[model samples]
Target: MAEGKMLEEKLFSKHLNEEMEVIIYLPKQYSPLYKYPLFIIQDGKDYIRFGKLPKLVDELTGSAQIQKSIFAFLPYKTVEDRRKKYHPDGEQNEAYIRFLAHELVPFLENLIPSFQMAGSRFLMGDSLGASVSLKACLKYPYTFGNAVLHSPFVNDDLMELVKQANPGMLKIFHIIGDQETEVETTNHTIDNFLAPNEALHNLIQEKGFESEFHLFEGGHRWTYWQPFLKPSLKYMLPAHTFDLESMES
Candidate 1:
C-alpha cells in the first residue's frame, strides 16, 4: 500500500505530431511471463492525486481483491491546452485518441504483452477526463469493454456517441454528486455537476449496456472519488477466483 514499487512518467514521442507524456503504475505482482490488463486514465495527474490509484492497487492486490493490472496515466497539458485536448472538441482531441488507440497502446503492448486489446482494459477519467473515456469507449467498443466515469462533463456530441455504441460491448460505472452546480464549468453558462451525468447514466442504461449510476450526498470533489475508487477497480478488474475466506484459514 505504500505507493507500490515505483511510479513513473515518461514522454511518449510519436512520429506524427507531438510528444505525449504517460504515467505508468506497476503493481508489485506485475510479471513478464504474463500479460496484464490496462486501465488508461486521462487527466492523469488528477487521478494520481485524487485516487491515489497506485497505492490502492498495492493494497487491494496485496489482499486479493483483484488481480495485478496496469494504470496508463496520461498527463495532458495545463490551462487552455488541457481543455482543448481533453474536451470532446479540443483541437488535439483526435490526435490524442490516435496516440492511445494507434500508437501508445501498441507500443506499450509490445513492451508488456498483458496490455492487450480493450477487453482486457478499462478507460477512466474524472469530469472531462470522464467524457473522453466515454468517447474512447464508443470509438473502440470492442477494444474497451469497460469504463469508470466520475462526474463526467457531458455534452451533445458525447451524447450522440453514447447513443451510437453497441450496447453489448460497453459496460459503464458512472457516479455524480447530489449538490453539483454551475460553478464547476468554464463557460459559467451551464451547471454540469449532476443533471448531465444523471442523464447520461439513464441514457446508457436505456441503450442496454450493463451500467450503474450512483449519486452520493456530496459536491464535485476528489474526497468523494477516493473512497469509491476501490469499487471501481473491483468492477473494472474482476478477481479471477475469490473466496469467502482466505486459503490460510
Candidate 2:
C-alpha cells in the first residue's frame, strides 16, 4: 500500500472573501532539486480517497511511465458549498475562478518553489467539478495549460466557451460513459452526459486541440473513472519515453 504523503494547507482568499482547504499529495521521492508538474483536482477528497489517486500516482511513477507530479485537491465545505463554487452559474463562480488563478497558483508557487512554469499546471475534476476545471482553464488559458474532465455537467454556456477558446493554448483529456444518459448534476437534476460530452468532443476535434476523448463502458461514477486514471495520466503527461511492446509484454 505504497502512497504519496498528504499535507493540508489553509488559505484565506480575498477573491472569494473566504478561507478554503487544500490537500496536497507529494510523491514518494519529492525533492526541492527538480521542478514537477502540478495537478489540481476539484472535489479533492473524493479523488484522494475514492479515486485511489495516491496509490495510482505511486504505481505510475514507480513504473517510470508517467511524470512524478504533485497532486492538490480542493474540497468544498458541503454539497451546497460545492454547488456554489463549482457550478458555472453559481454565485461564487467568478470569485472561485479568480481564487484558482489569482490566489491558489501564487500560493503553490511560493510554497513549493520547485514547480515548473505555468504550462506544467493541470486542472482535473469529475462531474460538476469537471465543468469547473474546464471553465477555470478556459477563463485563464495562459495560467493552466491542461485539463482532465470526467463526465462533466455541460450546458450551453460551457459549449459556447469551448467553441470560442483557442485550442492551441490548452490540452484536454475527456472521458464519458456510454450509459451516462441520466447523470445527476449539482442541482440534483438528471441530464444526458453522453450527448454533451460527444458534442464537446466534436467541438474539440473541430477546434484542432491536442486532446483525447474516450467513451468508456460504465456510467458516471468512480467505477469507470478509477480504471481510466492511469491511461489519462499517460496520455496527458508521459514522464519517460514509454515502450508499448514492453508494456504489452
TM-score for each of the candidates: 0.89, 0.93
Backbone-clash count (model 2): 0
Summarize candidate 1's per-residue lDDT along 51-145 as a digit string, tens digits: 78888888888888887777888876775667776788888777676666777777666656564556777889888788878887889776677
What lDDT tens digits, residue by residue, belong to model 2 across residues 76-167?
Answer: 89999998889899989889999999999888877763444556899999988999999999999989989999989888999999999998
The prediction achieving the highest lDDT against the true structure is 2
On a 0 to 1 TM-score scale, where does candidate 2 land against the true structure? 0.93
For each candidate in the order shown, give its overall lDDT on alpha carbons. 0.76, 0.86
